[model samples]
Structure formats: structure tokens, C-alpha cells
Target: MRGVPGRLRPRSLRTRLVLIATVLATAAVLVCQATGLTLMRSWLIGQVDDRLTDFRPPSPVFRDIADGTAPVRRPPPHEALPSDFRVYFYDAEGRLLPDSLGSGRSEPRLARTIGDGLPEDGRPATVPAEDGDGDWRVVADPGPDGMRAVVALPLDSVRDATSRLLWFSLAVGAVTAAGVVLLGGAAVSLGLRPLTRVEHTARSITSGELEQNVADTSPDTEVGRLGLAFNTMLDQLRAALHRKDRTERGLRRFMADAGHELRTPLTSLQGFAELLLHDPHMSRSRRREAHELIAQNADRMSRLVDSLFLLAKLGDAPTTEHGPVDLLSLAADGIAASAVRHPARRVTLAPLTAGGVGDSGELDVVEGRGDPHQLAQVLSNLLDNACTHTPPGARLQVRVGSLRAGPRTGGTERPGRTGANPPLPSGTPVHVVEVADDGPGLSPQDAQQVFDRFYRAPPAAGVSGDSGSGLGLAIASTIAEAHGGRLELDTGPGEGCTFRLLLPAGRP
Candidate 1:
């Protein structure tokens, strides 16, 4: 690799495939030609033997030769001893006697080939002619009057025909080889077109254009399936990389926001600590004020860290322990705490009114399956979000109940209902809770990203640090979703804001 150039290296798959196909095709053609030649030669030799087997010597000549009279000499070309066949005779004593078709010029070799009499098995045998002119297919058999007859046919015509055929076959094979080279190359290229596109797109990816994708092909073909699968993998890889990029960007932003939030409290603590340290004679009241400020900022920092950690855990850890929890009791506890914490705040608990609604007089109970503590945390965060944003005189309502989305009046009965107990229609179940406040609500833009981490609502004049952290709604939303529920905000400018939370019910 170091000494050789890249182009000279045999790295192309298509070239290898085409080369293999051409070689195999050429070999196949050669085998066919060889088989055809062999079969043709056998067929020609069989025809010669068949003619010799059926041949009969002239009756007068056969009798004369058998009785010791002189045999006839070679005839004229038109009547020349069956064209090229040389007929011979032999006495029962194994003496060679010539008849039609004189072969004095090549008699000895022919005699040696024919022998003194007819062969016992009587099959034709091919042997070289005298003077080594060409091949001959000779047969010997018993003729009339105890005389043995031998016939020899020169193979010159068959050799010539075969030679010509061989030449023609060679020419055809050469042409076929050339055709294979040409057509095989073209076919291989066409078959691998999708792979070529994949290679091009892969090269582009190497050059940092990861957005480029190979074109998809049909799934029925091998190369097409390969291309489609590769493109799918590329799509998935691209999506994963994009998600990683967004995550990195979000992480950077989160760190920046965390640093900015932490800096305020840290700076405050440092200033207060320095004041206490540097001024030993400072006034007691001033010293107490610094202490309280320091404590408050310390608590804020701790809470921010805890919120960030909780969000991180939501993704990394498995879900919390879950079971049936009474939703009504959780809501009441959270709402009561919020009202007590803000003594002047008007927090009201309202009965949820809907078909198949909970009965307040009968101590309506709605049970949701989840980790009780986490669910309580979700309720508390929602209350805090509402309390901090709502004005002091604003009315806040905690609404809870169940609702059926479709066919509310069906004949089906609710869970735990028996014929003796009550006939509540069996229906699909859904749990709903709403935290509503009659106060200045968020604008559309703010409401859109209200659950986004680090999102801060538009500031009001008298807002406290309770709304400063900006992670309560985001955490609460994540917690709700983690419990197979979702928190959605329905608010507009000047309209009272309501945070609607929906949870999965017994029915899908």
C-alpha cells in the first residue's frame, strides 16, 4: 500500500465480479465446444463404420478371388470402388489378395493394419493409412466362398470437416469471450448502480456532509434491499447525532443558567460572611440582618441544586415506587399548605363537575396509581406555582374529579360497582385535576414554553423569590408525565390561568 498507487490496487468489487463472470462464461463455452467436437467426430466415424458394415464385394470378383483367379484392378473415377474405399481379399490360409481400388503405393501399411483375415469380433478399428496420408476406419469380415473381405475408408474428409468445425468453434468462442467481456461489464455496472450511489454518498459523509443520504431502492432486489437498509441506518445515525448535538447545546445553556443563578446567592453569602468577619464591632441588628440574608440565599442555592438533580434523576433512574393513591386527599393537603403558608391568599377547593363525577357529599375519592410522595410533590409544586404568580386578593381553586371521554351513558358499569351497590354506567375512565387562579395570566408566548426548564414568566411588580427559580413548573410537568400523566397550561393574557393535569385511568 505504501509503495503502490491507490488506482493500481485491486479494490473494486464490480471489476472482480465482472472478471469472474467473464472467465466462467468463457470456460463454459470452451467445454461446450470440446464436447460438440468429440460428439461430431464419433458421429462421423459411426457413419463410416455403418457404410463399411453394409458393403458387399462384387459377386463375380469375390468368386474369382476365392477360386484363385486374378483380382480386378482399380476402376475409373466414376466407377472407382465405392469412391475412396479400398477393398482387399484374403484366402482362408491368411494370404493378402488385392481386388478393387488398387493400393500398391500404400499396401504394406494397410496390410499390417488389416492383418491376414477378418477380425474375430468384426468391429471397425481406426488406424493410420500407409504413407501416413491420414486416418482410416477399416473393417474386415467373412465374404462369399470362405474368402475374407476387408474395407478401408480414408478419414481425410472427416478430418477436413472437423478441422473446419474446430476453426469455426474457436472463432465463435473468441467472439463469445469478447461479448462476455463487454456485456458482463455493462451488466455488472448496472446491477451495482445502487452500491455506487451508496459509495458516493458515503464519500460525501466522510467529507462532512452527513446530511447527504443514499437514494432508496426497491426491497425486492438484493442491491436495492442493501441500499434501502443502508439509507435507513444512515437516517437513524443522523437522527442520533442530531439529538446529541441538541443535548450538548441544552447542557451548555443549562450550565450557564445554573452558574448565573448560583452566583447571586454565592456572592451574597460571601459579602455577608466578609462583613461579619471583617467588622467585629458591627451593630447587632446589622449583624442579624446579614445572617438572615445569608441563610435565605443559602437555602435558595440548595433548592436550585436539588431541583437540577431531580431532573437529572428523572432520565437516569428507573421509575419510583408506585401504588394506588387517593388523589383527593393529596390535593387537599397541598392546597391547605399553600393557603397556610400564604395566610392572606384565598385558596378554594371546588368540586369537579362532569359525567360520572365524584360525589363530594359521599366523600368522593379518586385513586391514581403512582408513588405517593412524588405525586404529592407534583401537587405541591403546582400550588406553589399558582400562589407565587397570583396576587394576594386573587381567588385560587383546587378542582379534582374523574371524567369519561366517550359513550358516558353506556350500559357498562364502573369498577367496584355491583348490582346491589349501585348501577353506575361502565365506561372508559380518566382522571383530571385543575389548579385555577383568578389573576393576571401569561401571554401566549409564555404559555407555549411554560413547562420548559429555566423558563421565567413575565415579571410582575410585587413578585417574590418564590417565582425566581423558574424550575417548579418544569419539574412538576416532568413528574406528572413520569406518572403516565401530562400537565398542560390553558392561559391567555388577562384571562385567569388554569394548569390542567390529566392522569391515566382504569380504562385505556
Candidate 2:
């Protein structure tokens, strides 16, 4: 019951268009038909009135009848006058003249009505028939000797003609309206086909078919433009859904990994505390060792929790104090730290330009805009990751340079940048810091998501039990992005890995 109006209404666009067009066309046709019929009926009635006005009786006979001088034989009214016409006579005193024209067939007895009201003027007028048959177009004519004669023509023929034409016009109008509806519906459907396709695509997408796309993307027509926009929206929505799914999966994995990491430390702390509590006869040295172990595990859990909190903050909106930073200086510091941390590994700063090799003074200063502390941390993390994954004595190089004109800032590669030296506008210099290491490079699959939180690649074959939490690279990536920079990895199996941090250069 609630849906009755919805079901009865023209809900579809095509139906509404056709229905509206047909209604308007039908109205216009009806108006024209009415106008034409009215004019034609008026003209027909005018002709009848003209005939009535021009009517004349036989002059001699009328004069004789007026003078009452001759009683000559005369034809009856029906025989003398046209079949559809009648005649009535009146004396000078406006009284009916009965048996005036040898009244045969008694011409509907209109004498009293015509004689009482009709004037001696030669104009026609319409009056009701005395016999109640129909209307009559009557005109009064003044004869000789103050005599008056009235001529009336029945309007039945005009009425019948107009009636026939009205029905005919209605029939033709109905046919034309039907044609308009059929043809208009077809045209409207054809015109709306692109929109229909877009609707179908949208429906399919709502049903979890994210790959659906509208086909008509031409920019020529309105529907074509709509299709293009619809397709673009679909693409964006699909990408958003993919990002959401990926994010959900990553969150689940992060929870699992964080729990596992925290659980180990918690278990260690619990076990050590229980040992100290239960072992009343234990030696002082053993109790102190247990206390130290508990503290270490507690510290590990605290660090893990801190990393998780930091990641949450970074993921939402990371706030940083910006300043001019020298990538070269940061790279040098990272190299030095790596050397001290992994004493056996050789860590050095590599010169980017041809002029300098093994000399820090000769290299150009790669200045950028970022939080100095965050940038330093990113460099440190990259270096540490390199040393942790590589074997001892592996040579790691930190290369820093500035591109005079290169890809745009924020890691978007400019179009038509196929050449090694692509022509680009020179402004907003970009700083590049590469931390390259001679280690087992990540597989393609691993490199794809290396920056994801809690994601860790398999350690090198010789390395075992690397106890580092995997938030270093993820945090570094987030910080770089927060500073409007990006960290990219260029690596392949057996080719070693190069983690490149690109930052927008700042004014010195």
C-alpha cells in the first residue's frame, strides 16, 4: 500500500521523458484541432447565414400576396424552397400570415416565433426551432407594401459536419500521440544509454565488483562527461577500498606481532620474578642476576609500547618543528655511528660528484627542509638496518647529493622522464641521501611492503636471532613523509639494497 504511488509513477527517466513529450505534443495537437474545427464550423455556419440573408421570394408573387390582388396558384413551401429551408410571412402589423404560401407540409409552424421577434433587417440570427428540432439561422426581409418575410435554415448540417470532424481529429491526434510516445521513448533510451551503463557499473561496485568501469568516457556529450567522471570516481573508490583492506590487514598483523613481542618480555620478567620469589635459599649472586633479567625484559616491553604509541601518532598526524638540515652531515654521522656499532663493518661516505672521492670537504652540502632530529633518526635507522642484516665486514656507503633539476618533490615522477637526465624546471632543489650496503637484497615481494609497520624480511642466511623490532623502517618512512619527503628502495636479489631518502631542498 505504501508503494502504490511509486509503482504507478513513471520512475524511470526514459518513461518520464516520453510521457512528458507525449503529453505536450498531445495538448498542442488538441489545441490545433480545436482551433481548426472551430474555424471550419464558423465558416460553415457563415455560409448558411449568407444563404439565409440572400434569400428572396418570387417578386411578383410576393407583391401579389402583399397587395392581395391576385389569387393565382402557387407551389407549396416545400416544393418552392430548398429542403433544409423554411419561409414564414407576416403582415404589416407583425401578425402571422397563415396559408400564405399555400402552406404544404406545415413548415414546422415557426410563424409565431419568427413574426414576434425577427426584425425587417437583412441580417441573419440564430433562434430555437418552434418544433424543438434544432437551432435555425433566420433572417427577416421587408417586401413591398410593408410586408415582411422570414427565411430560416436548419443548423443540423453544420452540427453534424463539425461533430464528424471532431471525432476524426481526436482519432488522428491519438495516433500521433502514440507515435510520439514510442519514438520519444526510443530516442530517450538511446540518449541515456551511457548513464545506464554508469548506473550498472555503480550497482556492480556496490555488490563488491570493484573492477567495474563505465565504457563511454568520451568528453563530447553530457552523458559522456558524466561517464568519465563516474569512471574516475569508481577508480578512486576502488583504490580507497584497497587501501582500507590493506590497512586492516596490516593492523591485524601489527597487533599479533606486538603481542608476540611484548609476551616474550613479559614471560621472561614473570619467570625471573617467580624464581627470585620462590627460591628462598638461592645465592645473592643468582638473585641479582634474576633482578637484572627482569629489568631488561621490562625495558624491552617499555620500548615496544613506546614504538607502538609513536607509530599511532605518526599515522594520524605527525607534528614536527621544521628546520634546514644537511643530508651530507647527517649521512656522515650515521656512517660514523655504524662504524662504532659494528666495528668490523666498513662504513664510509661516498662522494656523489666526480671531483671528490674519500674527501668529505670536496662533496657539496645537500641541504633540505625537515625536522633535523627526525632526519637524523631516519639515517641512523637505515644504517642500523643495513649493518644488522649484512655480514660483518660488509662495506656500507652513505652517498649524499643534491639534484639541480630532477623529479618533482614528494616522490612524484614527472611524465616523459625516461632518460637518465630528463629535462626539468630548475627550482626547489631535491636532496638525495643513499644508504647502500653489500648485503642480501630483498625479494621483489618483500621490497613492495618493506616500509609497512612490523614488516620484517628474512634475515640473511648467516645471521640468526636479530632481536630488533621492525618499526625502524616504518617510522623512518612516516617521518620522511611527514616532512614532505619520501624513502624509496632500489634493490634486487644478489644486487644488494640501496635505501634512498629524497627530501625537498631548503633555502640556505
Candidate 3:
């Protein structure tokens, strides 16, 4: 037979609260018990003292005495005292005196009182004593003619009374303590009710109810503070969510604009090329010109497609590897290549004394493992953008170095220019790469939007034809992000534009 599995039991909050309250209540009861015991003991002792002080022995009679004045009968020994009191008499030297209690039913009480002495008050000194049958309160006193007297009363009656009262008090105290514990637990649970409400509200908020706020009946308490903090967090989250929505909308609009722009060029190029192919009797020069046009348009379309592909890849691809890729060397190589490709344009390389590299001596590689090919694509886009934008004979300068440590560079704007050269803030270290040109720079308005996809700056005066797909800077910016860096533009109406790329030198 299968053994029965034990059922899981849920813990009770009320029970825990009751237990805590009960422990404290029990402690309080114990303290009260101890205090009562002490007070009762003292009162009982005081009662005994009072009884002894108030007690008096019966007066001696002369009828049975041989000499009336001498009380010859000597009060029959213990005969001077009442039936409830056992009496003994002693001489001035403190020696035991005779007593009649020896032949009475109170002989045991008499025996216990034998050795007692009288106090200075001519009254008996009360002493605690026991005779097998029960406890006794014995008192000793002086008698006439240098004699002493002693008396005793059984303590059983007083003891019984005190014991009954003590037991009653203990019973009452136990009941009161239990009641207090129960009441205290209930009070605690009621006081914490607001917290439970807050918990419920928080759970509701987690289910996308951002507008819900914790109910605050008491504003001056901890629960109120918690509610306020929660509301504040919710406010911030709502704002962030709104901003994210806006950004997504803007990206979608930009993608649509890019698609529209690409479609126009593609349709024109296709139609023109097909027209040229259908003419069989075309002259050699005309055919050559048609062929060149087709080639140029096809190349332009290819470049556009390549830019879009690069942007999409940068946006989605994960960076997982990092290693040194010498930006300085890469810059020199790019300039040499561009110079050779476009011999008409002047390209200059301003080499710093030291090359910028990662802190680990790996050429400021994107620290985390990332695709090197993508990183190179980013640099290539930046260099190509500078080459294409600048006019022939313009001097292009590339600088690769580390950012100066300390105090941020701050600037507003230059006259007639939209670009600003802000100083690097203090204590912000970075690897800096600059690509500058001597051609007329972009306007302030254009500079801000230059990195946006499908955005093209208005052509400068005297430039012949529209030559770019407007994705150069956008693609470059995307590449920079993949490398954990930013591409910024500095340009003005008169001043040449400077594109600065800053990458962190340390591990991400």
C-alpha cells in the first residue's frame, strides 16, 4: 500500500500575531504575579504583627491563690490566656515558667511556645512555629514579679485564607492575560489593514493599470509614504512609455520616406536603361553615353541598397567580439585609398604622436565580442561621407587621439553657422576620431538632422547634380552605435564641417 502523503498546511498570519501578543502578555502577567506575591507576603506579615499587638491575656484571679497579692495560682500556668491562645510564663532570668496547657487539648501548642521570650513591651514576642498538626504564631510576654508569659495561635486559618486569595488572583490574572493577547492580536491586524490595501493596489498596477494609485486614508503614516513613492514611480514609467511610443512612430515615418526616395530613382533608372536597349540603330557615341548613364544609375542604386542594408544590419546585429583595430592606421589607409580613387580631391592625414587604443592595449576595440566587419563598415561609411561631401581640392584632415581629461568644452554657436564645438566635460575620457573638411559646412538646422536617415542637406551653390542617397551619415551613426560610440557633427555656414566620433576606451 502506498504511504499517505502529508498535506501542506498554510501558515496563519493571525496565529503568528496572537502568539507574539501572548508571549508579551504572559511576561506581563508573570511580573504582576511576582509583584502581588511580594505585596501579599508583606501584608500577611503585617497582619500577624497587628494581631500579636492587639492580643491581651486574661487578668489573673485571686480566689484560688494562697496569697492573693502574689497570684499564688499563677493563672494556672497557661490558664491566664484564651482557649485559642497557648501561653507560657518565664522568670526574670528568661527561664521557662509552668503552664496548664500540658494537660489540655492544646499541649502541642504549649510545647511549641515553651522556649519563646517576651518583648520589651511586656507583651509576647510573636515567633513562627510548627507542631506537626499545623503552623502556629507564638507570642511571649513578661508577667508580674519578674515572670514572663508566652502565647501561641495556629496559623492554619490565616494560611488558608491567604492561599485561597492567591489562587483566585492567579486564576483572574491568567484569564485577563489571555484576553489581552487576543485583543492585542486583533488590534495589530486592524492597524495593518492599510498595508494590505496597498499590496492589492500594487498587484493591480502590475497588470498594466498605470493610472491606479494606492488609496491613502492617512497621509501622515508610513503607508502614505509608500503610496506616494509608488505613484511617483508610476508617473516616471508612464512618461518613459510615452516617449518610447513617439520614437517608434518617428522611426516608422522615416523608413517610409526612405522607401519613397529609393523608388523614384529606381523607376527612372530602369525606364531609361530599357529605352536605350530597345533602340537597335543607335550611334556608337550615343550608345556609349547611354551605357554610361545606365552604369552610373545602376551604381547609384547599388550604393543606396548597400547603405540601407548596413543600417538594418547595425540595428539588429549583436556585438559579441572585441579586439584591437588601429583607427590611426585605418584612417591612413582610408585616406590613401580615397586619394588614389579620387585623384582630383586633396586628402590629408594628420597623424598624432600616439595612436588611440583600448585600455587593454587593443586599439579601442569594442570591448565585448563584436563583429569586426560591422565595425569596419562604420568607419568606411564615415570616411566615404567626408570624401563625397567635400568639393574637389578641399583639404580633408583626420585626427586620431585620446580625449583630454578634465573640464568639458562648452560652446553655443558660431556666427552664420549651425555647428558648435563644445569642449569635452571634465573627467570624461574617450577615444576621439575627427574627420574635417575645408568645404562650406552644413547650416545649424541641417547639422542637427544630418544623422537622420533619408535626410539630405540642401546642395551648395554651383554644385552640378544631386549625387547622394542621404544615408551616409545615418549609416555612419548606426555603425558607431554598434561600436558603442557616437558620431557628432560640427559645422557652420562658413566654417568647414568636422565629424567627430567618440568611443569609450575601457571595457563596456
TM-score of each: 0.81, 0.76, 0.52
How many pairs of residues collide in each model?
2, 0, 21
Off by over 4 Å in 1: 1-11, 24-28, 58-82, 94-101, 104-118, 130-133, 144-147, 183-195, 213-231, 355-363, 405-428
Question: What is the Cα root-mean-square deviation between model 3 and the actual structure?
Answer: 10.9
TM-score-sorted candidate list, best first: 1, 2, 3
Model 2 whole-model lDDT (C-alpha atoms): 0.75
lDDT of 3 at 234: 80
Cα miss at 258, model 1 (Å)? 1.4
Query: Which structure among the candidates has the greatest lDDT?
Result: 2
Off by over 4 Å in 3: 1-222, 273-292, 318-320, 352-372, 405-425
Candidate 1: deviation at residue 436, Å?
Answer: 1.0
lDDT of 1: 0.74
Give the candidates in order of lDDT, highest first.
Answer: 2, 1, 3
- Give a tens-digit lDDT track for model 2, residues 1-508: 9989988997778888999999999999899999999999999999998887776877676667666687545575556654566666777777766534433333443546443566547878777766766677878887776767778777888889999999988998899899998888889898888788888878987898878788888899888899888888877987898899998987798899988888899999889988978888999899888888888888878978888888788778764577777777888887887778877778878766424335454577777777788788889889889888876656788888765434432233443211112123445466778788778787878777677667788888777655477888888888877776667776778778877776666533
Candidate lDDT scores, in order, read: 0.74, 0.75, 0.63
Could you give candidate 3's per-residue lDDT for residues 138-207 as a string of tens digits? 5655456555555566566667766876787678768877787778767878877888888888888888
Cα error, residue 301 of model 2, in Å, equals 1.9
Model 3: lowest-lDDT 10 consecutive positions = 405-414
